[model samples]
Target: GESVGLHLPTLSVQEGDNSIINCAYSNSASDYFIWYKQESGKGPQFIIDIRSNMDKRQGQRVTVLLNKTVKHLSLQIAATQPGDSAVYFCAENESGGGADGLTFGKGTHLIIQP
Candidate 1:
């Protein structure tokens, strides 16, 4: 069966260092990709997003990379801080701007090591 999900369960990074979180998606039909951050006791918050047409996109301190050939996606965080410690998730939308909700990955727990 096809699967769309994150590749790692957790990632530990030192403060001020860069962090990379990986995800794998199965549905090539997915056109939109979004990365979200979820702190403990809080809902997922949007971080960055990229469309399937592009292979990479950058935000303030973050970058989203997509590899359609292998169906992989990655989020890179520059200068990871303690506040950046949270569960990160990758979501995909295949409905092509339709009303259907996105399908989210399991999520990767990002821990900032002091």
Candidate 2:
């Protein structure tokens, strides 16, 4: 289950164009960061993940960047397709706190335009 602790936001991008989704997390102690993509009526699917020790990580055509200094995170998707349209959100786990300590951010709806 996902947490709806804040207002939902939206981002629209054109098909074949690169899309960048930004997230700002508040837990300075968080050691792990994850990006999730959720289609309507479905569970959140893992996109990519990063750790406090690393500044960036990439998966397939997706990239995740974590800036602990500013407590910021962002996901970049290359050549987005219609299938890429979904609700994307970021989750973080406090240092030493495993999956059980995961905190979700307010999600943003990604819209792909052809």
Pick the TM-score winner: 1
TM per candidate: 0.93, 0.89
Q: What lDDT tens digits, residue by residue, belong to model 1 across residues 1-114?
A: 344698889999899999999999888788889999999999999999999899999999999999999999999999999999999999888865543788888999999999
* Model number with the top lDDT: 1
Candidate-wise lDDT, in order: 0.91, 0.84
Q: For each candidate, C-alpha RMSD in Å? A: 1.8, 3.3
Instruction: Give me candidate 1's TM-score against the actual structure.
Output: 0.93
For residues 1-114, what per-residue lDDT tens digits would candidate 2 score against the true structure? 333232338888989999888888766777888989999999999998898999999999999988889788888999999999999988888665445766898888999999
Off by over 4 Å in 2: 1-8, 97-99
Candidate 1 lDDT score relative to the true structure: 0.91
| Clash count list over all predictions | 0, 0
